[model samples]
Target: MRVLVFALGEDDAPRVVQFARQLGAVVDVVVAASHLSSGAARIAGVGRVLAPDRPCDGSAEAVAALLASLASEYDVVAAEANSLCGDALPRAAAQLGAPMVSHVVAIEDGALLHPVQAGRAIAATRVDPLFFCTVRGDAFAAAPLGSHPAPIVPVPAPPAGDTIRLVRAAARHTDSGLTQARAVVGLGRGAANPAFSARAAALAEALGAAVAGTRPAVDAGAVPESALVGQSGRSISPDLYIALGVSGAWQHFAGVRDAKTIVAINSDAHAPIFEWADYAWVADLEGALPELLAALKR
Candidate 1:
């Protein structure tokens, strides 16, 4: 089987490429070379790297056209499940009249395994050989850069007529820290107190984690609006998610269902977060914060 990987962003490229290799032999990779620091094509199991002559930023229509054109040669085409790829891949699939899958976590029994019903259950789907998929970044480890660099070929951008153009982007919109964080510290209503919020931030610092919060915590002024994680906010799939004083609402949990490990700390043992958390600490945040911080420091 031959696989084609579409990685327009540097952050999720390695992980998406690694996942693609698991599906089949990754021969050609359509990448954003200027976005990467070094030999962006120096990834393990890749042969030729196809880079665009023009910039890939906000070029969803062009990328889609490129993918649809080359997709016939490969059995599977894939990318990480992000906003850009999410926009492009669907368009490409539609053009090819092909089936597509998103948020793919694993491959089992020759079927793509993805979550359904807001992560309530797993669904095994089998698409035709010529199919498109977007992988969950946190599901696979990033592929290490290989010593041998693949040959880079510059492909011309197709005519993307009548496409929405990006004028200017806010710095905050580009901050994908929470989605890319290996570990995340989530603040809830329990951490709304100023003192507890301080301790939570310290804990996040200790863990080298990005700090996020539920709607209530953000509304209570415990965290910034950018830190909010829920249905209305960004969905994250960090490797480790530690919640402080969190009572899990389904909307909030939906954003973090892809997390590898969930640890919820709340005084209420019956808190909704506990039901989903792998580890539950039934303790008040006021008392638990100091001890936890001390242990982490030690």
Candidate 2:
């Protein structure tokens, strides 16, 4: 099967490469060249790279143009399941009249496998001959670097329309240190108070870690929208993940399930987060966070 994989951002390249190799297809990587180059390099092995001529940001116009450019090249299209490229995949599928699946973790038995019921249930869905799917980033390991380098090829033709320009961007700074963070500290609704946020931040700072939160905290204003960690939030798979007062709902679990190590802190010992966590600490978050911060300082 020939697969056209969309590399939405820098972080997306690794998993998309893995998926491409798994299908054993010639991979066509569609990218916004100026914004991302690693994605262009990662899938060079498959040897089909399609980049836009204009400065295409992740916009509806850009998506439309990209779809137009890539229409005839491949049989199946896959994307990194994320906000930047999420809306584009579905729209493209609808336009091409192809079957579409979103947030799929795997492809098994010749069908797409996705999580349902807030990630509590797994469902397998089969699409028609022409298929489009968005894949979860942490679901698979990136393709390993080989001894021989993959060849780089230029994409044919320029983009059709003018590039989508960003008027202004108020980039929200996240202390969750998510970009290159090796360790993460996640706070939930039980730690939604302002005082709790401060303590969580302190703990994260002391440990040189990033801070994340559950959807409830974001919805309740405990943290900024960027700090949420769940199905709707940013997906993280750090070396060490510390979940404070998080109940381990499937939505939240899916985001962090790939972490190498998990430590949970909650007052209730029976919380579901503990079941998946490597270590569970049943304690008051307010009390525990400060103590942990103090201890880590030394």
Candidate 3:
């Protein structure tokens, strides 16, 4: 059997190739060179790699078309579940009239295992050969690199086929990767102001923590929406999470539910954040933060 993997983001080529290796011995991978390192060809089980000279912007359609065209040659065409794969693979599946299984956690007995009901249960799905699928990011470890690496065969940028094209590109501002941070400082409405947020950021820098925020804090521009921590935003599983001036509503709490330790600081004695916090400090943040920052600096 043979498989093709579309590579992007943290759900990257190596891990997806690790997943592909289970379905087939010959795992041929495709990657957006801009998003994935060419070093993916060196992974242990991979057979070949198709990468563009430049993973040209606005090439999602082109990549989807290419994967669809390759369907006949490979038993499975798959990617790790990410924004890019979530968009491109479905289009490939549509074009080829192939079944697409998403959020796959494992392959068991010729069927894919998917998480259901917020990951409380698993469902087994049997998809035919020549299908499209996306494995979840957490499904596999990266296929380790070895001394001998495969040759990186460059694929030309395919025509976007007169479909939607890019008129311009603007870079989005990025914060520290929240998912990989060991420690996180979460700002609620208490740090929504410029002065308060700045001090909180200083404290975060001292603690070596990434900064995330609640909706009100994001609305106040205390932190970007990308750093927002809530049910609607990114979920984090950090070793330490500090909540400041936050009222622990379920929506915000849901994102940090997996944190190993939670510390809450708020002036309001009755703030809901204290209810479930591992450590609670009922004190004014304006006074408390400076002391903490000073202590860390010292």
Candidate 4:
């Protein structure tokens, strides 16, 4: 099979390429950034790297057009299931009159396995050979760098046309550590009080963990939306997840289902989070957090 992977110039690009290569497909990458280290392509085990003359400027339409033009030459088109590629691949599929699958976790026996019903269930789907699909980055390991670098093939910029234009871009002030951290300290509704929230942050710092929160915590203004971990928020696979005063709603669990070890600290013994936790501590977070912090320091 011939696979075209829309590279986004990060770990996601290599992740998707690794997935395609696992299927024994001949993989080619089309980088959607202005400039990227060709070494990235080499490490991804790609046959060729198709880079644009300039950066993509966050234009999904341009990417869609490029994918649409190249769709016919390849048996399958794939990308990372991220905000940018998620928008482009569907449009590209529409242009090719092909089916599209998003958030695909595994490809097995000619079927795709993906999360359904807000990640409460898994669904298997089959698509035409000539189809577009996006792979979940966390599901696949990064492709190893090879001894030889892949050839860089420059592609022309997308023509300017009637597409939504980005007037300006501003960087958001959110803790990216929550997404990249191996250890995450999660706050919930129980930690809604300013005092308790501050303690949570302190505890997180003491443990060298990134601080995150549930939707309720975000709604209560205890943390930014980027720190929210739930069905509508970012999914993560931290090595250790420490839930402080969490109720353990399914929505929240969905985000951390992949966590290797879940430790819950809540006053209520019967809290739903305890059901999913590998370790449970029944104590008030306001008091317990300080003790935990002191213990860790000692």
Candidate 5:
């Protein structure tokens, strides 16, 4: 059987393709409508790649066309449950009359697994035959390594058709720093002040960490979009994630829940973020930051 996966550079390539191959299927990729930074020709374990049949405008249309092309040849199609491609999966699945499951965190017992209860629990679902799922980030443990490297082939552009027109590209900012950071400092509404970010930056620098913030903090202009970490923002799996004055909204916690270690500092001990954190610090952040920085130096 053939499986189609969305490609964006090499970041999720290893993980997404790994999952598809585990199901004993050959993997293919769908390219973006716009230009991409990386080419998959050299990547191993990727068979044929399918690009937009026609020059398209929106990502959804481009993906739809690719999925439609593969529907005849492949038994299933898969996509990562991420912001860019999340909406497309369900819609395409519906259009093709294919069964689909999203937010899949694991796969076992011939079924896909999903997390529930603010990511505190998991639920297993069995999809109908001839359907696929969108895998959640950090959901399941990776499978054993594979030795065979599949050849990648670029698909020729399809004939012109009425498609979503392309508009001027806008610059997007994300907290990519947190993705690879060993430590992260997350600020929230409680620290929603221009002054706080400066102090937070200092703390981050001293600790050799990257800076991140909750949705409210970014919305309040306390931090840039680049520092946002939440459901509506970037997901971070840092080794150490530190939250200062963050109340820990469910949306915010989902982004950092996968961190290897988490430390939350807030005046209220019952803050929701504390439930998932590894260490809790109940104190005044204004007073704690400077001391924390000083201590790190020693």
Candidate 6:
């Protein structure tokens, strides 16, 4: 099969390339960013690397146009399931009149396996040939950089008109802010109240930890969507993850599964989070938070 994999110098590129090779594909990699080095393409073990003449700063329309133009030549189009690729792939797929899938965890029996209903169940979907999709970065091992380097192919600049242009890029807190934190304090439904939310922030600050939240907390306006840690949000591997009032749903657990130590504080003994916690405490968050904060102060 002929596969075109999009790349942006992300950690997940090697893994996405490895997956393409597993399918016995003749892979062609497209570097979507402005800076191009043959080294990245060499590491991916592809024969050809296509790059734009000039670097584009996260412009979905230019990428979509490029991918749409190239879509007909390849049997499959794939990219790492990231913010940039996530937006561009769907737009490109729409241009080609092809189906698109996101958050793909695995490929089994010619079908894509991905989480559905917020990780409540796994769904296997089979798309028609010449489909576009995104693969989860953590699901596969990265391919080693090969000794041989691939040839670079430079493409012309995309047309500029009637497209949504990026004015300026703002640094996202979720990018390096939360992911780099050694300790993370995760708030859930119990932290929805203004009092509990403020306490959670104070405790996190006192403990020198980053504050994260579940989807419910984000939906309830307790925190921004960037602070959400779950299957649908940012995946982190912190040294310590303290989940407060989190029920331990699979979607939320997927993000913190690699934490060195998991500490769960929930009132319900049967809360699913307790099953995976290294330390589980059954206590009301309202009552327990103050005491915990006071003890920490002393």
Per-residue CA lDDT of model 4 for 150-180, tens digit only, reads 8888877566562333211101212244445
Deviating ranges (above 4 Å) for candidate 2: 42-44, 59-65, 146-182, 190-202, 205-210, 218-228, 234-239, 245-247, 257-261, 266-285
All candidates' lDDT scores?
A: 0.77, 0.70, 0.73, 0.77, 0.65, 0.77
Residue pair clashes in candidate 1:
none
Per-residue lDDT of candidate 3, residues 1-298 (tens digit): 8888866443256777888888765887776553344567677877777775555343457658767766688888887664445567889898888888876778899889975554446799997787888775434767788667666777765554523332121011123456567899999998788888899988888888999999899898888655777554555678999998999988788668778999999999998889989999999888988888888889
Model 6: per-residue Cα lDDT at residue 28:
85
What's the CA error at residue 114 for candidate 5, in Å? 1.4
* Runs in model 4 lying further than 4 Å from the true structure: 58-70, 159-181, 187-205, 208-234, 266-271, 282-288
Itemize residue pairs with steric clashes in candidate 4: 34-54, 34-55, 43-145
The per-residue C-alpha lDDT of model 6 at residue 77 equals: 92
Clashing pairs in 3: none
lDDT of 1 by residue, 162-193 (tens): 23332111123235466679899999988888
Position 46, candidate 1: lDDT: 78
**How do the residues 1-298 of candidate 2 rate in per-residue lDDT, one tens digit apiece?**
7887766555566677777667777776766553454446654455656665544544645664576467666777887665445666777778777778877778787767888776778899986657777787667666665444344454643364445441110123212336347888888889878888888878877778888888888788876655567787566789999888789998899788878999999999899998899998999986788788878877
Ranking, TM-score, top scorer first? 4, 2, 5, 1, 3, 6
TM-score against native, each model? 0.70, 0.74, 0.68, 0.75, 0.73, 0.68
- lDDT-wise, the better of 3 and 5 is 3
Report the candidate with higher lDDT, 2 versus 6.
6
Best by TM-score: 4
Evaluation by lDDT, superior candidate among 4 and 5: 4
**lDDT, candidate 5, 73-183, per-residue tens:** 676677655544455566667778888776666668767787666566778887665775666544433333345534434564434563444221111222244445778
Off by over 4 Å in 6: 59-62, 161-228, 234-254, 257-261, 264-277, 280-298
